[model samples]
Target chain A: MPFWLDAVRRFERAIGVPVERFVTSDAYFDLLPHLKRAQSQLEDAVAAMTEEWYRLVNLPSGSDVRQMREQLSRMERQIERLTKQLADRDATGPTPTVRKRDQNG
Target chain B: MWPLLGSDLAGRVGRDLERSLWRARNGLRYVQAMSRPREGATPKDVVWKRDRAELWRYRSETPIRYAPPVVIVHSLVSRSYILDLRPGSSHVEYLLAQGFDVFMLDWGIPDERDADNSFETYVDEYMPLAVDAALAVSGAHEVTLSGYCLGGVFGILYAASYSEPPVRNLVLLATPIDFSQMGPMVAAVASGRLDTAELLDETGNVPPDALYTGFYMQAPTKEIAQYATLLENLWNDEFVDAYQAMAQWSRDHVPLPGAATRQIVDDLIRRNVLASGRWELGGREIDFGDVQANVLNAVAVKDNVVPLAVTEPVMQLVGEPSKRDELRLTGGHVTFGAGSHAFKHTLPALSRWLADHSDELDSPKER
Candidate 1:
């Protein structure tokens, strides 16, 4: 072991205990929500400004790309569902349709 | 007295000079990112894949002693490499050496396309198929479903929802069952102070940065402390390599799918359904009592991520008392898979329980 290693370990412990307590404290948790809200608002504002700039320049924005992606994703999901249904039908065979005259008889 | 003082001074100076030289050399390597350790280095093959999910079956030179194959389900929010972190420190490596057939179910990083994937998508669609693929490849009648963190929640839900799931044994590592006991970050979401919808970006997934921030808030100064420890241990090459590997894994996070995030926020966090036994999925009520597999819940005593309070209650909720067991070990959350704690305590105890429950093969299968 190095000569300074012991001193460094002691210093770390001295600094670590108090910081751990402060972070785990109720006061810190109470302040967290406000910080998160501010961050979210800042992000939203920046995105909105960027979108506005894109519109003024006659260019597509991130939201436009996102919309297209969402449409594609929806189509993919529909195809998956249809494929699953077909597989299930194939496995169990097709259901027989009831005739009105046969039902009445 | 003067002569003794001079000798002591000389010794101290020499040690200080040596320390400085080691620090300089190691610091350069760290900065240049040279000789960084490789993670997930174990040899494995993808037995099955659907969308972004993959089932990896690890290869072994030795024949298997256990009958049923063990499949590991990793957490959604993080990468799966933590289990196979390094050569000697890997959990999967230990299991393979113990002569057990091992497989890993990894949920790859989600993008916009996976935004609409709900719990139903994973439980009903992906998990069953992954298990079937493992069974098909291994020619095993049943498998031991082992899950870590949120993966354990998925396993519990899957086993409980299905009438006769082909799971012979279930192992949970640092899994949180009682969400009410989870810390303030979860409480903020449950209390509606933080809107989960607002957290989703244009990509239709919760960004990795946001998830990292949540984890960071739990212990703001821990990273600084870890750096200090790293500096102290920088003189040792082995210590530095291990530290670098763990540090990289800690910072690496994956985006959570939008629909699954919403469902978890509403059903698991806010309602606390699993703890209360009121959870339902796919038009069926999920009852832990319905899980017929033998259960093992491993809780880390020093884990702040998933405290004992949150993880210990699963013993009462799942399976019969005779079939359920708990292994309470002294270490942090990642200790079950990595570090000396895993090799010394976790792997041995876990393997003993698994071997007791598993049927022995008549003869070892050749590679």
Candidate 2:
């Protein structure tokens, strides 16, 4: 390692302690919720605009596509369950039946 | 004294010049992306597949000496390559050498199809079938279930849910049991300040970048520090390769399914179900005391991803006191599977505990 790089590392270490402390502090966490709320509000605004644009264009919105995909995923899950049941049945084979008394008896 | 000092200075200058040249050469290669390090290069055959999940049986020339095979369950939000990171530093490779028949359950990259995959889907549906497949392939009645991170939560659910779980031994690596201590991002969701629904994109999943951002926020300056270190060590090929592989893995995250995220936030984080011992999955109450498998909960001392406080409670909740053990390992979260610390300390300790619990085969079975 170079001498200059070592000095840079030393500087980094000096500042890093306080930076890390602040990042993990209660104040940072308290500030995060507000930031998250603002982000969510912005996302909602964009989504509403996108939906309106899709309505004007006579095209399905992203939300619509998501719903359809979710429905398809549900059907896929059902099919998977059915397939698993069939496989389980095949593995177990048919249940044995009780034999009746002979006709001669 | 002056002559000696002059000679020493000259020697230092000469060495520094040589290193600078090597650094320049290596930096050029790095920028061009030349001689990229290969990762997850260990040979493995997919023994079973369902949806995006695949159970991989690692190929080994050595004979299997253990009765019950080891089945690794990886976390959903990351690639499974971390376990088999590189040939020399792979946990899978280490286990193979230790004479355990190893199988890894990799939840492949998820998109729209897996948006509805919840805890029940993993714990109830996929895990049981994956375990059965591993058992059938290895001709073993039971298996040693090793789960990493979120996967370990699934292992806990699976073992506790079943009356007779086929797991003979359970190993949890850096698995979060108390989500309240999982840092600010999770705390936001837990406190209901940040809704999980807002995190989901149109694909009905939390995007990879979102997950990456969450992790990145934990140590915002770490990336800058790492790059500085990387630049300094650019002359060393071994260091360069290791750095590249680890850096790639750190940035690489997969989308988390929306339904699973919701459940995780509500049940695990908000309610703190795992810690409280009051979790219900698929109408069945999950009780950790019901887990009959001998448990080994390994918590990394310096894991920012899943802090020690987040994982330490598992030692109290799981199985009988006599049947459970905790390993407090040194280093960060990835140390259990990758890097020098794993090869030196983590693997040996894990293998020793696993071997002690495992039954030896009368004769070794060839691959």
Candidate 3:
């Protein structure tokens, strides 16, 4: 599986939804990557979603396959870059968040 | 003394002594809220309301009862009741009416064991358990998850670190991603005047009273002088009731576990790791990109604890579609969940957004 798909599947489970329909739909697969702006993306997605994506992810404002793909793609890359680094072996242990308290009664 | 022992004189002395004894009776355990009580959770100004844990399960009300639920995970410092204060003021109640099966985690004040608790415990234990408990209660196949302030960070961590998190639309309110920019308090913790290690050692959990005092001192006038003014200006029953309720809530501090407090300081505040997306909790590495749900980022314009400066960094990390709408509320931190205004401003926007994007989420892995 593609790194994006592998990562997307994990988040899909985390988010709890199907993806094949989302990625395969005609309206989304051909979505342009350049028009990543939220507003235009929403307008275009709403226009296309009336047919293709009204179900997979029920976003309030209409967002197209192009924008959703862009967003998810960005997220996928981020997760991959971040998690891959942490997965390295020289890692000691995860640091813990601390709060100090004065012992005096 | 013997000469003045007449009944009348002695009785007078006895009365004086009794008055002195009576005055001394007020012991200082949990510092009592001095002013009269007031209503704690009335919606002064709100918009929409409702909640649920996962996607598809937390939906808007009416023609939408079948709407999926949205679970709201609240911060540890404040009470969840803030989300559901008065009828006109309740966030959870509004969501219920909106058709979302609302599940909320009220991390009731931490005791001694809670002190031993670490951030890992919250991410691994409390949050997951809360998610599981909510699922069992609602019996929903999926749920939507949202959080405010500390809870927001927890939501992100839980979603990112775990291969399977029970959430759909991920919402964050007044949550900070970059601790390096957190105002004076963060500076203090970063420095050691607010010695987290020492404080934790004294008691397993840092006392709520001390934390409240620190926060109060951050804005002493707001905590003290303002209340005195409000008392003078508002004389109505509702005013008094509201004052008392808020007063009680403010004073009702929950002890933070020593370990958890330590980790927060060392990992986030001190190391400034969460922003770098290098934070870890509960034996899992937190990767913000791991969160790919439809996100609704609501920020407060004048948030002191989680300032907008830090918030922007958090949103940018989402990697999700930045919506045609990012809501910046026009009030303090608490207004997002309290008052009638929240319905109009906060909940409606939230529920409407969640409803529109509920299905992009998945369910828990079957055991």
Misplaced by over 4 Å in model 3 are: A1-105, B1-66, B223-225, B322-325, B359-367
| lDDT (10s digit) by residue, model 3, range B208-284 | 77677656544443433334434343434455445545566666666776777777888878887878865655444
Clash tally for model 2: 0
TM-score leaderboard ranking: 1, 2, 3
Among these predictions, the greatest DockQ belongs to 1
lDDT against the true structure, each candidate = 0.82, 0.84, 0.59
| Candidate 1 lDDT by residue in tens digits, B204-308 | 889999888878767666666577778887777888878877877877889999999998899888998878754678766777876779999999999988999
- Residue B57 lDDT (model 3): 28
DockQ of each: 0.19, 0.15, 0.01
lDDT, candidate 2, B1-367, per-residue tens: 9999999999999998998998998888776653453447689999988788999999989899986899999998888889987778799999999899999999988877788889988887788878888877888888899999999988888877776678889999999989889887777677776678778886789999989987877767666667888888988988887777777787788899999999888888899998976587786666788788999999999998899999999988988788999999997999987778899999999999999999988898898
Q: How well does chain A score by TM in each candidate?
A: 0.62, 0.67, 0.27
Highest-lDDT candidate: 2
List, residue by residue over A31-72, the lDDT tens digit for candidate 3: 422232455468656677574555556653344454565466
C-alpha positional error of residue B171 in candidate 2 after TM-score superposition, expressed in Å? 1.0
- As for candidate 2, its clashing pairs are none
- Write one digit per residue (lDDT tens) for candidate 2, span A64-105: 877888788778767877886888678663221211112221
lDDT of candidate model 2 versus the reference:
0.84
